[model samples]
Target: MKKKMMVGGLLPALVLSTCGLAGAQPVAMDTLTAMEQNPDAGSQMRASTEPVTQESLQEMRRQLEEQLQQAQELQNRLNAQLGSLEKRMKKVEKKSWEPPVEIHGYGRLRWDKHRYEDRNDPNDYKTIWLNLFTKYRINDRWALHSEHEFENNLTTNHGAYEGQGGYNEPGGKKYSRPVLQLYAEGRVGEVNVKAGRYYLQSPYKFTFDDKIDGWQISYGIPTKWGRKANFTLSAGNTYSKIFYGDKENESNYWNEGGDGNLKVVSLIGEIPVAKNTNLAMHYGKIKRRNDRLERKTWSIGFDTKINRDLKFWAGIAKSDSQTLNKSHFLQLQYKEARPDIPGSYDIYIKKYLQRGHSGMTNWFNDDIAEFTHGDYKEENIANNGNDKVFQYSRWGEFNGLRIGVDFVPTRNTKLLINYTFGKMGKCLDKDPGRRYDYSFFRTQWEMYF
Candidate 1:
């Protein structure tokens, strides 16, 4: 019976392959008759009553086992071939395997033209500067970054300082030139160690005037809650030309030990609240040893999405310039549309208030200039024949406001317009050169890739 069953199942394949199926009429009739008697019966019936032989039973078992083994082998081969084809398809399309390394940078050929509306001195000049940046990535785990900046105010013809006295250049003249970024970083485990001259994002403000030449170590990590956190500690001297000491001749850089050394530590954290909303906070302390000047500041900020087309942010900051003094700053921002939209607009407003002296000395005095590496050494820190430490209204006016707008027409192009107003304690008003209300406007464009 078993042999008959085995032979019956194989008959269909044999008939279909070699018998031209149409000529197998007798076999089809036999198959139908056997199926009617036993639904699973074979097309070729053997003598079932012959007392089934052991050899025949063994043969049927062997054939079924062979067919099963063959079917499994064919299945494995097909799976392997399908896998190879999929791999080739992935190779043909980008973004399939590991992500590729990418590097990008941005720069601004800035030109600031001002007309001294309140004339202690009436003058109009255009100052130009160029900033360049570049970066490289070796793989997912390592990267190299650099930025070079050069500035030459062709109208004033001084890069380091707009004034007459500066470090002599090779051409028997003084001029500012390009400066190197001079920093390298490597990642190990979860920490990134960096060494060399680099830019510090201080809590005081975000501008070139506050950037210092220094070496720093920084690390960042994301918490289980998905918040981003960062920490940094750095030590460096103030720039040259700033004054320090009880007398003019004793003046020098802060780290040279005339007054003392300069140091700074900072931390920042950011958390996401919604798809387009976030919260941010920052804290930092700056120490000046030689002149006994110290500063600590902190800020808290939040960004919220009002709708698909609008976003807003607000922040408040407080600062302690020394042990007994305090200052405050507040800012607000609103975006009409994102950079994805042509002619999209952004607006920002800021206010600043200081109750006590903002550094050791208020005005840009010769000593303060030399002490802090004053790039604007001749800006005059003294209160014009007065010992008021700070000009009465300039540093003491306890109040200032700023408003700005950004218009982006494309992904790589932008326009910025801003205005500022404050009371200079001792700066003069136009009529008699007496310090009074102050206001100014600035406009610029930037391109990047």
Candidate 2:
């Protein structure tokens, strides 16, 4: 008998196939002879089996080892590709952050007129006021913010006593440039810090309270309900030094311990009420170096909305001159939900009141006199060229009433019309049983950029 072996294919699997076997159909004698011959490598004679060969076993083992090595090489290639992809993803994430510089601003042009019995040189002027804000972010927790304002009476441009009866020499069309806010803001742990020149917050908002030039510290915590509980404290200048007479002082800022400056400090806090509503409480005291309230004031109020259309706002402030102060505001407004939608429209009506003895507080962003409290109106309203008696106000001292309308015809423009009527509770010193009523109308076109 003879033994036959197969070495037709180099691959392990195909080397064991029997599809090309030599005997397909044989005669009886031939079949007997084939059965008698040793079967091909994948088969054996029925009566006996061929012994395994050491050399054939070694070849099979070698092929298996080669296949293992190829699989490992393929796996290494896949891992290398995966590592490169991960590195690229990390780099892209680092580049995708908020912009480092920002700019925004708002401007308004107003045609304001005040008329009363026997008024000379009608108090009418179309004034343009613009404010621009910019910010540069240094990092995740630090930034520099700067804001400036410009005002043009469209007739003359100079720094004059801007209050009542103020004067600007009629000359060229120029604007007054004033820096409103410039500050470096950052955070250390949970505490927020601000330094440089910025408006000192007085309760809700006070313009004449004077800008502070010092440092501030603040903090806030956010709740799951989307409201933040916040507190702020600030220190800066109020009224500065005194340089009176032969006392060798060049200014009249009392309690300036040789620094020729005065210090004012303020503390304010806010508490969340509900969705889109909150209460703010604030206290501010201007101290002489001797530690007395040179100009002290406080404010606490609630500003909220109902059904997203109607709003109720009320607040009060008290100072040495503004005692028993009070204020109230209510408005019904309808505006487009967002800027992109085409059907954008806004119309609103508002009512405001401030009355009582020294009943006054300052509302910044408001140029209307009836809404102003204390001396801010007394000084500025007269400059509108109105009768001194006509300046009677419900401002922090007298009783006042205001009605205003705001309408938006376009996405970026708004028109505002407001009227204020006021009367003092007591008689004017110059006149007996004074019954002078004060009122004015202002029309404004406002835009944002």
Candidate 3:
């Protein structure tokens, strides 16, 4: 009986110890041994430990479940944050590959009047001009640019009885359908390059508006004074109705049978000589097909700031020609007109003396002597008595004074007034006894967008 009771007690204690070990808290070995030695004591101890163990396990399990749910929630929040960051990174990467584009331009309305000393009639006209410019940045160092122009003369009636058949009549509007300038520009280190149809502004070539189909390369030179200096080389062929005439006309030298082109090669340089001053030089050669006509031109000039609000420029130009081969100019300006600032104003005065051969085309004042008579038409003077015959060729010898004022009355809008007066040079009339005086007045309103 005693052996059987001992065995039974040991078996119960072993089972209880095993069950306790599987729980979060284990039973003590001393308590298990004590329970094994007494049957009644073991039964009482089991009854007492059972309720406490069951409640403690239930509390522990509840805590563990709560901790597990919190851990899972924290993990989900981290994943959501990580996903948001990844999406932002992807958006930034996509933006880096897209190019930027810009578009802007201006509109202008102008009134022009021409008066001659010997003629009773005055030429008056009005015109509208529109320009559109666009730029696209392909990358950090490469870009593309384009400009388009449209022009129309609004003064169609010269006089009620003068008829409607004239150069400024209806259907005489002018425009460049595709583009006035289209070019690719890029920069590599200190070197810059431009190719395709673009504007060329040189001393002896087109001043500002004419376009050439070719290329230009410029280098930024390093100087000891840390000033700005540049050297440029350009080669191109100029084709414009203003200078070359229409294709059907015989004067369209670039398209006709005479070598099919007028070529121009030019070198220009700007050197900083002092503070707020620069010395400029230019050399250009113009060659026609078959070597029919070749002209070598050179110019030297200097631009300086007299004060914070005053500036001056003077230059002399010469060409290798037997007749009419000299030109000089002096300009002084005060202040500057800022288009963005209302009530801003600038005033300037310029004096220029140009010979026919010196500047093949005077871009600034091409129409200074457009209505003057040349010596070849002297026979008409006897019959008309001071009546003038129009000069077909626009480029000729003339000396003139130009005064201008530019004022901005509102943001992005400008008003300009200019007056010019001059006398014909020897190339226009060989007779020193006769005087061909002319005056011009122009007023323009421009709005920028």
Q: Per model, state how many residue pairs clash.
A: 29, 22, 0
- How far off is residue 65 in model 2, in Å? 19
lDDT of 1: 0.49
Per-residue C-alpha lDDT of model 1 across residues 1-449, encoded as one tens digit per residue: 77756766664464343334334545544554454456334323544423334565455445544554565677699999999999888766534544343344554544433223244752333445556666565555665667767655555566644343334532222333245564666777877766665666543331112344565666766655465556666556543211222112233422222232455555655666556667776766655565545555666667677776455656555555322234455666676635556778878787765332233222221111111122111233466766434222222232467788888888767787776666533311211233346555566667666
Q: For each candidate, C-alpha RMSD in Å?
A: 9.6, 12.2, 14.2
Task: Give the per-residue lDDT of model 2 (tens digit) for 1-449.
Answer: 33323322222344222112223212322432443453453454423434445565556545644554565677698899999999888767645755678898889887887544333554666678888999898887999999888776654343322422233322211222277689999999999999988767554453134566889999998965598888999887632211111122224322212232567678888888788778887776655464332445566777777666666666655544323334455545555333333345455555554423112123322444421122212334465767454333222223455666666666767777878766543321222244345567889887888
Residue 31 Cα positional deviation in candidate 3, in Å, after optimal superposition: 53
**Candidate 3 segments exceeding 4 Å error:** 1-99, 157-178, 203-209, 224-226, 240-260, 363-395, 426-433
lDDT of each: 0.49, 0.54, 0.66
Better of 1 and 3 by TM-score: 3
| lDDT (10s digit) by residue, model 3, range 10-86 | 64455444444434223433443343454466465455443224454345445544544565677699999999999
Clashing pairs in 3: none
Scored by lDDT, the top model is: 3
Total backbone clashes of candidate 2, pairs 3 or more residues apart or in separate chains: 22
Quick one: ranking by lDDT, best first?
A: 3, 2, 1
Worst 10 residues of 2 by lDDT: 241-250
